[model samples]
Target: MNEDRRGLLAATAAAALAAVAGPAKAQESETPAGPPPGTPEGNPGDFDFLTGEWRIHHRWRSGPQSAEWLEFDGEATVVGILGGICSVEELRIPARNLFGMGLRLLDQERNVWQDHWVNKNSGVVAAPGEYGGFTNGVGTWSSIYDQDGVTMISQGIWDEITPTSTRWRQRISADNGATWQETWIMHWRRA
Candidate 1:
């Protein structure tokens, strides 16, 4: 009888160990953290052209200064952060002599890009804008804002970019959307 009781107690202990270890073993076999199924990894080549610092020259034509040119220097830096969800660009221009930061969030679910911009001087941000998927490696964004009682529409396009340089244009429309004016033209070269 004593031997039989000892055997039964050992059996009970073994059963308890099995019950506790089963779930842990199953969890360990489960899939580890990784990119979601069907989600491709981000390519460094896609953002290579924006890797370096840039110097910008701006020109514009409007009103009495119509057809006239204004020049300024702008510096740009692009960085990939937040698990590759977006790339943030910080630009400084000595012309308006303002510093601004913009964020380009890449939505993997919708495959679209959303842009947000804020003026550092006045700490005001215009309405956020969304652009469709990139085509032929080019994209455009525009926004309207009232600055010191002057209504200004700002438009920009990124064209012909490589890992080293990108061509960008910024234009302003004063007369709403009916009539447009080009206020700033900027070409960014890697520095």
Candidate 2:
């Protein structure tokens, strides 16, 4: 009798464990973390030119002399992260006492790249993600960012991209892109 009771208890415990774990296992199997099955990938190697260390010359303007470009020299490190699904850039400008980071990811389903930017000044990864891809060797990405309850469009363009150097610019439009003003530009060379 005791042997039968022990067997029944073991069976019941096993059933209970399976019941608790069954839904979680099914949920995981139903959805995946990466690209979905049959998801067409975006342009492979579109950002390959950016996957290296670089000496960066930055041009930025704000305030009373908003139209002027105040240039500074900086260093940047770019790495192919997330198994090539994304790349990250770390930038430092000692003269300006500034640091920034950019994370660029390719969405297979959307067939576009999303660029996320953040800086030490605001400490907010608050920039709306810019989404675009290279066309005819030129890349453009834009997103809306908020400032003091005002909506702004941030547009970025990559021009003169080459094996060792590239020129990129950032512009902001307060009037829904009807007009754009260049706010930042960077000239990057292989370091």
> TM-score per candidate, in order?
0.57, 0.68
Off by over 4 Å in 1: 1-48, 62-65, 124-126, 142-155, 171-181
lDDT of all predictions: 0.55, 0.68
User: Candidate 2 on 1-191: residue-level lDDT in tens?
Assistant: 14453344335334433432457766467432332233233575777788777899988885522666688899877765445666666678999898876767677677877665667686444322667777678887766667889898777888899899999998888887788888889999998
**Best candidate, lDDT:** 2
* Candidate 1 lDDT over residue span 75-141, tens digit each: 7666545455555566887667678756555556555444655567754433335333344686555
All candidates: CA RMSD (Å) = 20.6, 15.7
User: Per-residue lDDT for 181 in model 1?
Assistant: 59
Q: What TM-score would you give candidate 2 relative to the actual structure?
A: 0.68
Least accurate 10 contiguous residues by lDDT in model 2 = 31-40
